[model samples]
Target: MTISMDQQQTLGLSPNTLKGVHHIALNVKDMATSRHFYGAVLGLHELTGDEVPETLVTLVAQGKVANFRLPDGTILDLFGEPDLDAPHADPKQQFTRANHMAFDIAPELFDQAVAMLHQQQVPIDHGPVSRPTGRGIYFYDPDGFLLEIRCDP
Candidate 1:
């Protein structure tokens, strides 16, 4: 899957133009539950004031948006919409399960994460198994969005 310089030039590709993810926005069923899950269970910091974009806040009603900061400075924005009808993909198929967010944790905290998930009663959809990347687990959020926690060592 390596592309030569000529090929890259022919495709008008520019190196280093694309940056990593800035934020990920999701629509949730319950604001309180989602806030607790991301802010408490996962231990992410919730942003306030000008930290959130004015456009995103105005898209919905007031106080419907909650933004959580990841350890790597990526923002996870949650929109509270009680009647959201988002479709969840089945994890059995490869492509279907491709649409997921995977977060990395320290290798030592991997076991502790599993324990927390268990204590919280979140059902694991796939694994806490070893992969090319690391040990990981697939689980669903309260709103049925697929999420993964991987420990790279």
Candidate 2:
């Protein structure tokens, strides 16, 4: 699956221009629950206004947006809209599916993470399934966003 320089040029992408994820944004039904799940259960530290640039205030104001920093320093933004009642497509269903997000975890911590999720009584949608790249578990957030925590093989 390696793409050569010519192929990358044709695709209008260069490796040097590509950087890791800066942030991942999510829309949820409840701010408190989302915060507890991400901050308490998942161990992502909530970032305060003093930590983020003031320029993002407007963009983050669409809902009760709260930003958190992952262990690796990546940002995860949660937007809570209590009145958002639109039906969402089920992640388990392949048709008309929305994208799912996966977080990388150390291989040794995979089992521990699974145990923690189980202990917290989070619904496990599917897995500890083995893939070519690693082992992963698909689980739901309080708002039903399908999320995965995986360890590289």
Candidate 3:
């Protein structure tokens, strides 16, 4: 993935803009469960994350591709691989939720998500920390994957 400086410039690339994320395809033990968490609870509609493709959608996104397009142009790509070993959910097993993939949210919603997750009996590790950039809260996903809801200053 290494690119020379001249090649990078020719691609209209800069360190920062290219630094932004495109999308993250997560490995899920079950797609249905993930859809319930990501789509139903989190409010991300499935652009396609289904086994059976709809007639019209296939007509639009092309008749062949099956990808879930989220509202923010971000695809909530889900993979159902029962054979994949789940990563260690314990923080001691890893550090910085960034290693897993932090799902940043609005600072205002951090408390709400925490309370909701708590009510649902989900595990939360850290506080609503305020960084020089913004605020964040850390928690674990269904598979014990660490995630963060953050807001930039």
Candidate 4:
């Protein structure tokens, strides 16, 4: 989506000023479970050592943040909750319940991805629904965070 000079000026922003998403940060209930889920289950490689130097020491006591590298080189930062005993906000009650992250997959691998999810017994929220542009499947992570895997038609 290119922005014209006039549009950029009107918006007080420059065209091409912003590149792309560096990473997405999410608060997870359990670090170990989330780490295993993303790294082992999803096949995302964990970025350890220097990759995650500035950890969330302040937010969580003795807690560290983990960054996983996606196939596209996008990072997914999972931060463990500061207090596990504290009550978590219900996702159903939150206005952002519909908010989710969608990962693009190769068209050929779309069905394979669905099959993997099924083999793992992960509940499918909906889809293999079709659209003009593509097909997608919605599912939840261990933390109940909604995620989608989509492939362009």
Model 3 residue-pair collision total:
1
Ranking by lDDT: 2, 1, 4, 3
Name the candidate, 1 or 3, with the larger lDDT value: 1
lDDT of 1 by residue, 44-113 (tens): 9888676655555564347688888899898788877788644655535443212357666767777777
Report per-prediction Cα RMSD to one decimal.
17.1, 16.4, 17.9, 17.4
Give per-residue CA lDDT, model 3, range 84-127, as digits (tens): 55467663675322223455555555566566666656687786
Candidates sorted by TM-score, descending order? 2, 1, 4, 3
Global lDDT of model 1: 0.70
Tens-digit per-residue lDDT, 80-124, candidate 4: 764654243664553431235767777777787787778667888
The list of candidate 1 runs beyond 4 A from truth reads 1-9, 57-61, 85-153
| Candidate 2, position 30, lDDT | 83
Task: Flag the better candidate by TM-score, 3 or 4.
Answer: 4
Clash pairs (backbone) in predicted model 3: 133-153
C-alpha lDDT values of all predictions: 0.70, 0.70, 0.55, 0.69
User: Which candidate would rank higher by TM-score, 2 or 3?
Assistant: 2
Clash totals for all candidate models: 0, 0, 1, 0
